[model samples]
Target: MTAATQPRSVNSAAADDVAPIVQRLRETYARWTRRTPIEQMRDDWDELFRSRAQPWRINGFEAGGVAAEWIMAPDARANRTILYLHGGGFRMGSIDSHRDLMQRLSIAAGARVLGINYRLGPEHVFPAAVEDALSGYRWLLDSGVRSGSIAFAGDSAGGGLVLACMFAARAANLELPSAACLMSPWTDLAATGATFLSRADVDPLHQRPMILSMAKAYLGPSGNPLDPLASPLYGDLERLPPLLIQCGDCETILDDSVRLADRAAKAGVAAELEVYPSMIHVFQAYGELHAARQALASAGRFLGRYFTEQDKRPPEGRGDTRDCG
Candidate 1:
């Protein structure tokens, strides 16, 4: 699990609303050294969102063969869609675990968000999640959703799946979506990013061994760690849709986003990278976090125009990459 180290500057101040949440998570995390039952985790995940009340129009339906739900903010556009993939290392997470985030993104992007309950690993392994995600995309296309009107967005492992879904879609000869936004994406399941060491003392949530164990569970015993679909950081990035990658300097997988943006640039893709100072994995999940709201707003502005073909896109590989915190 080694790779070339890249220089990343740090910013000391984390948003005031974020520190307490991170501290709580860190304390709670210290108690669980091993995986918890998926059912219990699922309940806990949903419970975190229960305290936040929002009037969202949620509808349940099947996307391809997978069970899913459409989360729409009151004024969300019906024509445009954001296919959201939830993240729990591909082993946990479902529509329930992610409704709050999905609802927020739907409003931010002003598009309906279709979130799927993709099969989890250790029970459903690699390609199963990928396949379910693709099925949701297929359902969108079949239902006459224009490719340009749809955007792909996800966080952590789900963020990686956003890229994997596009790759899978390209292979199936389907049209690519307008753009994508990844939040603290776990692009390298191979756990090779130098940040696994560099950010070790900073990121409170993840470590190399933990990531490797999650990867092994998702990939099964024989799956290749470098399989392009499983680890999009190792995949070919040529001719994919425009990308907006948001990462935090304090996260162990920060390098995954940095290197991903580099690969996207080298492959002639339009990529924007924003590194927030002193943030952690999926910090966007915390509604109270100001940086979280800012990141989602940035993603909204990036993907908003695409929903209506009003793309006043900045040129590829522009100077938008920076410490935006």
Candidate 2:
């Protein structure tokens, strides 16, 4: 549970290294501003990143009276499947914005990743997203995929959803995944992390007040923002599968991942937490960035090891789950 050694800065000219991309992203945000309500931001993101290479088959499912798209990797036939949850502060984002990342993950895990376009908030709050995530998990299980062979992965809010699903599975006495991975999870939606203020200038994407507003919108009047299922860092972690968490040291949510790992370890869960230095929030979106590529490489390696181990382990009841647990 101790912190991994901080990665060295990739370049000395920090401003020169990030300014153009940041500026471009800012301009994109401005353009999004012109189109109000902000929920439509996912549409803009889907359009802007539409050219990214992600060849997948689309399937549909019903949740909360809404149809959700499941994007599955085309190459998958017999390999295991990963159910991916997309992150957008529980408000914006879709399967498309995360398509490239999930494609890489699908390739790395040697499995098809099914990315869910879950219901977002201010309209569908709290358990709405949680229920949709579980429904997606159930769909995978019902489709004949062994639960132990399946994995859950996500980034930011989706990362949080990953933990939520695991907790729900455990509570329901259902089978858990062989492994799970998260990228800078927003685990503590209550905005308890001090980094929100101290790291504001350095962290990109999440400005504290903005995230708080989104959190409030997602929680609604009946929900408790601190409920462990809502804010997973505060949840029980024992009996969970091997966990892989990756975070940028520069993000406001940095502490969320760090603390979650520490707590998971304390609760006897096997956890690996990697912190990439000087990277912004969900930097993996910038596949061209050096740090992003490195992070993905690390993720691929970790998943390869876990999947290989899973392949060796016999089925539960036939063999001890405790060894892998």
After TM-score superposition, the amount by which residue 296's alpha carbon in candidate 1 deviates from its true location, in angstroms, is 0.8
Q: Enumerate residue pairs that collide in model 2.
A: none
Lowest summed lDDT over 10 consecutive residues: which window, candidate 1?
316-325
lDDT of 2 by residue, 1-325 (tens): 3444222233422322555667766777787544476656767767666667455545455533335544444444344667788888888878777878887776666566667778888778998888888887876676566886677889999999999988987887778887888998999988888788778889756787877888888999888888988999888899888888888778887889878888887787778887777777787777767777777776766665655345665433222111111
Superposition error at 144 for model 1 (Å):
0.7
- Which stretches in model 1 have alpha-carbon errors above 4 Å? 1-14, 30-36, 310-325
lDDT of each: 0.81, 0.74
Task: Summing lDDT over every window of 10 consecutive residues in candidate 2, give the lowest-scoring window.
Answer: 316-325
Q: Which residue ranges in model 2 land beyond 4 Å of their true spot?
A: 1-16, 32-35, 55-77, 308-325
